[model samples]
Target: MIAETVTAFNERWWNNFLESTNVLKKTNVFHNCMQKQETASMREDVMKIIRLIAINNIPEFGFRLYIEGKNIASKELSSFFENFTPGNDEKFEEWSERAFGDKKFGIIINRGEKFNPTLVEKIAKKITPLTEKVGIPRLGVTFTIFIGNYGWTPLGIHTDGLGENVMHFHLGKGGKTMYTWDVETYEKIVEPANRFNNTKIEEILDKANVFDFEDGDIYFMPYGEYHVGKSDELSIGLTLWFNNHTESALAKKLIDSLLFNNLEESYEILPMDTSPYYDFENFEDVKKLFHNNFGDKNFLTLLESTYRDYKMALYSNAGFWEPPFPKAEKIDHNLNFKIKIKEPFKIIYYSDSDSLLNLFIRGKKISLINNSSIIDLIKKLNSGEQLQKETVFNTLDISWNLDIKKYVLDIFFENHIIIVDYA
Candidate 1:
């Protein structure tokens, strides 16, 4: 029998859930998954995000607002933010109601991890254990925030992209209901062209597997399930998407990454008589081009190396598809400060060779000389211990130039791998 609900979510629970053969094949709800304090913290972070939207701090592409199921135009949104001034004590729902007047509206923010570091940290703490057990997917994970009082999902009944499953965390002053239909069942009832039809929801409502959840609850739905959400009252939720790409998709992404990293543009035009058709001799030229770009490495070797870098970076960023924005302010290396690795994230490193080490910090890679001192220092940081800036520098090899040590520290500071507390 399918286990439809769990009392809580944690590493042990996740492991047990996965052990079930029907794990991803069914919809599951986790009740009281988040503690009251944790839910309150999440609500606070979401409010800050809403305020960021009001001040235009969030990028245009990061968020979308819909009124009565119609997407608001960018210019209109800009105008709305320009005139939106909330009182210090004003709640988000209150502002949302005032902004839209009587019309029902929904707001969705993509890449929410970039906007709130605290939320990301909290989520990572809960999720890292699962990842540690099963490993992260090649394509990584991303999160979206849904906030609204809209009666139905603005997108209508839809399935996410291929190989994408979602875990929704409900943090609500209200409640939400979700309806899902398996692919085979949905296809049998809905016409091909009208599969996404929101207007016809009544016709299929009784056929769906219904789930209603309130604050501190979580709902998990597998990939390829046709689903829609209903929130008749003000509510907010965060959904994390775990993207498990098909082999072909993974190959395409790796090739794209390789090309992006190695391909250099040349302004020179090819000879007029150059043949476009491939011959054995031309194939040699192709091989030479690969060699020139990749230093005599075979194509497979190049792909393997690229995949390693991608995976390490993804893992280092705590499976976030997009890492958090870099630290905004410049670091003053000369001043004394306490530094430590950011919570729930650590520097990932592997030795490429006896002489070189590959380090990934928040999805950015940096290469360094493979020295014992440097490795030891990284280990200490990863241990979650705070260290003095001067002490960190002193821990490095004395033979190394002062400038090199400072540059290394600067990279860590800028990439947000290390949090600095000014003394």
Candidate 2:
């Protein structure tokens, strides 16, 4: 019966572990602040980097090494493990025990979502202030227990697919260690070429920050950073990753809603072969194709209004018609300069195997024709070269087959990534 519950990826928010009030402290919850004066401010500053915050004296989080007392005879702890039945929040049920070939890889006991052990709940209760103070909305809590000897984890540098996570060591002996670097540092220190070999992270560890925690220590690492951890001997720890919303997340939320109906299966893109196939002479017809589809102001105007709806939604999400924050940065009205492809977003795409069109737009897989003309169009737009209005119109026209072209145009104009004003 349990195996019947296939775990689908959860996208909605559920972080309300406890009521939110006075969540941040001018000082530590169990001891002094790491930076006494800025302890409160650090709560907010941690957002700038991927969340990696640790403070001493978290207290009673891991009084015992495992579920049983640390001093309990090893045989006794072993006996308890042998007889253990999961409570409610242990997060391990999804995997079949044989998921891995080696038994020594250890077992992850899932206690189910409703079952948070007393110690686990205590840590979460203590953390509510920090998150509440930061003003990031919390939806719910998720936690798990890891039981194994030293070097037990996959230990490769990786990022979490779910929401934000907090790791706390309940009990362990020997060197259980964690190392991490922000996504920024990761893109620099580790060459993209060697990313496949897991050792790249370890080789670059000297350049990354290291985190060491004692029993009962609490560490918060925000989502989307590269990290890995391991212990020298058998250990037990609890991890919580709850859904949290940010301004970018809010923007994404609105965009996702607007495209919900047309959202197709996501396609992962690989690096393209840059070698050319068609001569530049072939592009004249491609140019004609784009001009015929997008030469008018009507499509551009529809695109602008759709984005206005997004900005309005953004304001309402803040419970106001205009948010206190400055206007969206990408919405510049300046049309005099050449339109350049926006920097900062990594582009990925996939085409319909049968139709041969490449589709893409910020995770929305856009399909365009597979010919050299289309490839040339994509590279030109991805490039930062100044684009004239003819260039701008053709850029949108290049991905001609996607039904959601209008939404894509709306996004380009709204975000100001595809400037139509380029002369």
Candidate 3:
């Protein structure tokens, strides 16, 4: 089962979550599976060390590393980060001995799934479905692990970028303690837009509220909050960075209008005014002239014709030209099974008349055929209605059309949409 935040973030909680600066949860998403990975990948483990140095122009009050309950001074980070030797086991042993053995703390910056080893990859797969269920965009989390016998954040107070975060003390014998200040107090201590002012730390230490997340505790930090933490004992933390995905419909509309336009059925280049007055410097000008003079008047009318003659089906991989699925050996539908759409997929369509229509599934257009006959079929499949075997025989009324089946199979291989036995 997936874990829940303290407030159970429904639509009603959006106002409070957004309006408030920082709210603390009662516990972290405590789990036992990630412990083995605590010492797993060294390269992934030490990824963020250099980013914490003061010379990086990063302000003192930013997401940074800490020792066992204390912050590492900026000047000391240089000598500390020199231990790792890229790709040499001998150098690594020498480095780890000096870095972990001498300095005693390690820094890792988990940017994304790019470095996902066995453990982090599994955690990502688990959380993806839960996010989808809650309408959250599936841009998975970043896993930054802190490894040390003693841990305290030397990064000082900081606010992460715009997104929610899950700080899980997934493995450790010690406990995690966090202190957060409301936005107002943080802004007063460090200028909202400027953190280089050498602000006194005493200002922030005064107004903060403290909380703790022991083993298995999961704390959800909503966006735009200032916080810092400390931990005792050998500990490993997996920080899951999450945020809503926002896409502007207008941008898509504009691109579609431009890429897909009305064109004349017959193409004949019009005579151009070669008087040098038509000279242009931009690509947009050439595009306008080309479309106006040689483009079709009803380009959409050619859509079906293009499909009929096309050798391969077009599967949308969001502009990725990956190979289309192999064609089925044969098309036969005398089966006795009812049909249903696959889980995690949705079929959507828009039609002027049954004969001319556009069908989309999982953000990809599946416009292989243009006919009113299949409209009923599309509706029934989307509605989760089970069809009788007779419908499959008919292939139009209670049945799904063969062409639809073929195209769906191509995409089903991609898992964009699927066909399944009726539940």
Candidate 4:
């Protein structure tokens, strides 16, 4: 019976579907025959729309914004505010200020079951068809809303959190959402020391590639890609969430096992190499060593197996994993630049002087070196010799701490250089 219900539910489209007075409507109708019961199809429809947009296609039509160009019914507005109870008037004011400021506010809505049924119904009716087509069932009928003011000042460049792909639909008379993926350009304007930190949202939004939306417009953006939005007037919109929850759950589990269960041994079997061989060593061997020491199996499999244990510990007892102390890497996109560390590490290249790119390894800045010096260092150090400080530091007039210098050397040691202890 459940299968039949699902089949019938999946086959029907809510917006155009008319509950025929005939047996056809009755076929999928919800009834405890002994007791009269009725269930609407909007919930199912909402699920369908999420599915449609998730597959990298904008649905044939975007979302609808029902507006009378007048204030929403006071009673309806009051009802809508019920679930949005302010912790205090000050808290409400704070939320409103943040939401209405020139910048975009991403309101991630979860626990959808807590919302009033009528509010849910209205949004569901508008969203169901699009979500249904996307096939992202995890999105269900639940959704999120992004609030903001009119114009560019309000929304800055930023990407959604990891694992969340959103189908954004505008729902106000003049609602508009703008976005783009030119994160490199965005970085030029908004400097996020580390993009993963949530508060860096403003910086991220500033750099996003921008596209504007009119009422009924829809756009799809996968997680990890940066974007931003603005509205011409007061705007309301819906963004459905679909993420790889299962994979994420497993990843968390695997991380927990690595951190807690085998932490002592993990340090022993660290993903490290001491072999003097420069590039000849098989990276696979290093990988296998890690697998053997950390717990036998591929990374993905290890994640899956360890997740259950992690879940138990995480839920029953509050436990979390702390990332290992950071290591840093320098990233360069300026290919035309030639850098040599002679004296002051002067770099000569035709890169956008205005662009500000952050180099990170494990979420910390090591330093930004001239690209030429980086290239020459790779070449000079690749001979696999313990590089002398004079040959290394003298070539690039950079001041260095003994430890930081060693850390830099470790990067070269991995593939390009060997530490020659010429004291």
Scored by TM-score, the top model is: 1
Residue-level lDDT of model 1, residues 339-371, one tens digit each, is 899878989999968989889988888888888
lDDT of each: 0.82, 0.41, 0.46, 0.39
Ranking by lDDT: 1, 3, 2, 4
Residue 227, candidate 3: Cα error in Å is 2.5
Task: Give a tens-digit lDDT track for model 4, residues 282-345.
Answer: 5654444453446555666655545543433222111111111222333122222222221111
Sorting all predicted structures by TM-score, with the top scorer first, yields 1, 3, 2, 4
Superposed model 4: Cα runs more than 4 Å off: 1-113, 117-142, 148-155, 184-208, 250-423
lDDT tens per residue, model 3, 1-423: 986544323443433433442333322233333333442342233332322222343324333445543556655554444433233333333444555664555454444232322343345344444453444323324555655544446555676665445545344445677777767876776775654222244556668777765554455565666777665554556666653323443234333434454332346455555546565544343455435523564554444333321212111111111222332432234434555654323455556454555665533445545655456666666676756645633655336556565454444334334344433
Candidate 2, residues 1-423, lDDT tens digits: the string is 564422111111112222211122111111111222332232122111111111212112221222211233445534443444332332222121322223334324332222222233234334444444444233334454555542625536776654554434344323356776777888787777654325555568787677766444445566666777665454445555555546566455555644442234444453454547854654443344333324554644534544544443322122111111211344333344455554422233344365575433322333444555445555676666656644545555565654443444445444323545534
Where is model 3 poorest over a 10-residue stretch in terms of lDDT? 311-320
**Poorest stretch of ten by lDDT in candidate 1:** 282-291
* TM-score of candidate 1 relative to the true fold: 0.85
